[model samples]
Target: MSLDAPYIARAAKPGQFVQIRCNDSFEPLLRRPFSIHRVKGEGSRVKDIEILYEVVGKGTEILAGKKEGDFIDVLGPLGNGFILPRTTNHERRTTNSEPRAIIIAGGIGAAPLVYLAEELTKKKIKTIILIGAKTKNLILCEKDFKKATPEVYISTDDGTYGSQGFVSKLFHKILKTTESKFETIVYVCGPHGMLKCIVDICQERKFECHASLEEKMACGIGVCLGCAVKTKSGIKLACKDGPVFNASELIW
Candidate 1:
């Protein structure tokens, strides 16, 4: 849902996230983590920032009760964000045949990709999003993503939505059939099993890939050392060092 956090909207970037306090009381004391789903407005005068989530726990249940005028405590836009291509000169970028992106998300992982897509589209870089979910109702963000780019593909565990299978199958099909025409990089976030499969495909084909990981974060800053992941460079905190890391860097 959208929040009128102008400060967060102004400072947020793709792949970065926020930590929210669900209630004023101390019962569910620690805050919960969320990705910045969308950021709006212009320059430093940002108007809104959005977050996508599910109510599977106590914190979320409390959050669902928030009213229109209610004030919620949020700490963000936190963590290192996606490292978007920095080249400002599109002519040069296109001339160099800079790689296009393929964004893969499963279930709620789609949240961050929408924001990432907005950044890529503004840069005029092509992006194709692949989304997969257990059912149609669980699928998220297709409409918003389509507005950023016309290329979107979806799959479902049941045949209730787009294709009746896993999203990785769609990726495999593209690799087996039409991938030679473009230079590609993959950006993915999903269940651990799902991500491993996707990363394996990219690794075998030698495609550069990045992944956004979610961890139980405490003290959203680094001091807590709660969100560590084993990376090729060594152990790093998902909160301070990343929620995003190169696929190659992860131990998997």
Candidate 2:
């Protein structure tokens, strides 16, 4: 079954995300959050939107098994994503040169990173991608990311492919080896534990970072209020206020 859902895409940003309900049944009571993936066209009418998700549990498995014609319910263009610093945003206002962007993905986290990379590339912004998985087979969208960024790095825990170490390790190594004194921004999407670790690293290194979070969701539009997360500011809904937030804003 072909899946199609029409949505307004006016608010989508590179790191923003959405929530989806794969089935009407309540067996899986919560909605699933997926990165905006990609938003096409402009204005009130969005030509297309894409989301890449891995089948992990009941909800996602149901989504994965869906045929081409199936229609899944989605509530979206939600959350605050990575906003380039005004200075940097202004510098790249007219030209794309000198905006250095780096993306890191773990497993299915590659989904949003791919979309983010694509957008950056369209703006003529230079990007680098670092993707990690336990093995090569688990690495998602290798070709897509490579196409978006001139430099792409791969790391596997088992040494089955690419660099044989943690993705974070490879990221640090790259930072060390590169001589380019450019302002760099980071966007990451992945498991909570992995994100926490990355956040720690970013804090220690003083790197500007943005992260897309995942949690149990229900309504996806904030009505359920099930995806609340504790932030430095206060309690906020992950499904509405975020699935994406600045690393500094998080209490982690």
| Best model number under lDDT | 1
Worst 10 residues of 2 by lDDT: 1-10
The candidate maximizing TM-score is: 1
lDDT tens digits by residue: candidate 1, 128-181: 888999899999998998999998888998969998888899888756765565
Instruction: Name model 1 segments beyond 4 Å from true.
Output: 86-96
TM-score for candidate 2, residues paired by index = 0.86
Q: Per-prediction TM-score, please?
A: 0.94, 0.86
Every candidate's CA RMSD: 2.1, 3.3
3-98 per-residue lDDT for model 2 (tens digits): 244453565677777778779998787677777676666566665777887777898889888776677787766777666532454655434435
Q: Rate the local accuracy (lDDT) of all candidates.
A: 0.87, 0.76
Runs off by more than 4 Å, candidate 2: 1-3, 9-11, 40-46, 85-97
Cα deviation in Å at residue 211, candidate 1?
Answer: 0.7
